[model samples]
Target: MSKVALVTGVGRRIGIAAAIAERLGNDGWDIAFNYWQPYDERMPWGRDAESRAELVRRLDRAGVRSLAVEADLEDAGAAEAIFERVGAELGAVGALVLSHAESVDSGLLDTTVESFDRHFAVNTRASWLLIREFGRRFTGEHGSGRVIALTSDHTVGNLPYGASKGALDRITLAAAHELAQLGITANVINPGPVDTGWMGPELIDTMVGLTPLGRLGTPADVANLAGFLCSPEGGWINGQLLYSNGGAK
Candidate 1:
């Protein structure tokens, strides 16, 4: 049977999220993608409609239906809008991947309440709100759907972004427990210093040297794992925080 999957914060990047979306699409999963507008200071993997449209085209070529929605997921209503779009365009969501988020690079002393609010809005509130809406609507009987959130290696770090991810990590676990009653498995994927656009080449090289894999993670690397987690083959897995880092601290 075909399924529907929602991937947020996807436009351009190394390839992890995109790879994940394509993988799901290839596996007969319809896709709903989200992209936040890019700032003028940077252009990540050509962060534009063209890039996403191309991805949608590719998914279509692969024989899967797809739709791209522009949304400010930080807003409380953003998740609802996305679901509504999917309901109208696709069908029930078989998987929800909360992959759209970022950091402002604020430190402990520099961290302000406003900044905290901003980060939590995108990284936390958005995910919870999506879960609230999706969880309430998605019935597990349709082959057990998945909730896979993108997290960071912050559970072991004290960075602001790390703290934000840690909060997401906790939330995923909690959701896993609560959503289990509905037969949905909630989990978080914490990728370490991936070579994605977020971490530049210099840092990636350093991390590669430090890691057991001896190679920086590509978007496909993370996406591959995401595919597995969303598969019925992974039904035995739930409420776990898995790392894709190559054994680096």
Candidate 2:
């Protein structure tokens, strides 16, 4: 099997996507990551230009090849472009980790049409397109292809983001069967309440109190599971939504 992986939404060093990329690189997989700075800049936790560069340096120091592609997943053509660039730069991707999202806190009564459409375009449509490209271009050995997506179930105040992620879950799980001929295992992971610089002090305390582990989930926690799922040992765990949420109720 080719030891190449494509990880999306790696725009921040503290983000889950960056952690997953680093973990896979440490596991000896050549890493190709996609990021959009504009998304981070607009978010409450602004962008860190140096962090992106530092992540690439870290991957390079791991003795594995690393490529960073700046992509706006909202563009319909970005999926194919990412695959083409990664294939030419590294090799055919054997594992795909989708950690990107278009999240904005808007309730059902307040969510606008534009916001809803953008959420689906990035979270749902882009995922489908990327997976489709992966299935079409995959040349890995039988039972070598892997697909994993990060998901959420928090929908009370975050309507569009949560709803689109639900669609993403279905689209990803379907690949486990639809792409079975290509020997791919697909699954969704709901890594609940990972702070990743988004939660405040009070929210952190509340989350810790709620979790059975007495602490909020970290990016590394999710990364560990993702790395395992991409390994050969994870081939049997397919078409399921596994929660790595520190037993948060």
Candidate 3:
């Protein structure tokens, strides 16, 4: 049986999640990806069902089995539902890519408790639950399992989003220390300010100027790092925040 990889937040064809899924498929891994349609519809950069279907079709053409699961990570039962679907449709998951995040922008002054909770539920809580389930179901008889989460280190205007990702970072590192005996490796990636239709013209120009590489980061840039981290050579790299940004400090 082909190894299975589960990637979350693949609601659009041009996003980072789609890139990661496609890269993994090309690498000979069956894919099980999760998306929240309603959430995507409400985002500033809305997504349609056809774009998602097109992504799945493209992955299918890569000659790997693919399963697209609609799940709301904010729901308490969402993690189990995702794993159950993957286990039934594909085989045991050998790798997990957590690219889904709540990107609601609220500065420290305007951030509300409800927004904070909601952000934590999706960004931090859901990731921990999924990791717990993945670790629970992984059988160490094979080589090893991989867990990679995408995060941001921003501090202002993204209070809830940034803080929640910080929580996810801690959870990932703890899993790395505790789950190593079971042949599991955990790491986080910070892909810094990729324009996935969320930024306006002014913001885009500002970000481009700030980037030392003289160009905005692309989904493919992040996907390349994700592919490498899940590969056999990446087994030795764990518990570290791998920055794929082009020297954007």
lDDT of each: 0.79, 0.95, 0.89
lDDT at 210 for candidate 2? Answer: 95
Kindly report which residue stretches of model 1 are placed more than 4 angstroms away from their true locations once superposed: 39-46, 140-143, 155-158
lDDT of 1 by residue, 136-193 (tens): 8895474487999988765333456777777888888898888877889988887777
CA lDDT, candidate 2, residue 178: 99
Clashing pairs in 1: 15-219, 16-219
Q: TM-scores for all candidates?
A: 0.91, 0.99, 0.97
Off by over 4 Å in 3: 140-143
Off by over 4 Å in 2: none
lDDT for position 116 in model 2: 97
Alpha carbon deviation, residue 179, candidate 3 (Å): 0.8
lDDT of 2 by residue, 150-176 (tens): 999979999999999999999998999
Per-residue CA lDDT of model 3 for 130-226, tens digit only, reads: 9999999997444479999999997699899999999999999898988887788999999998978778899888888888988889999999999
Query: What global local distance difference test value does model 1 have?
Result: 0.79
Compared with the true structure, model 2 gives a TM-score of 0.99
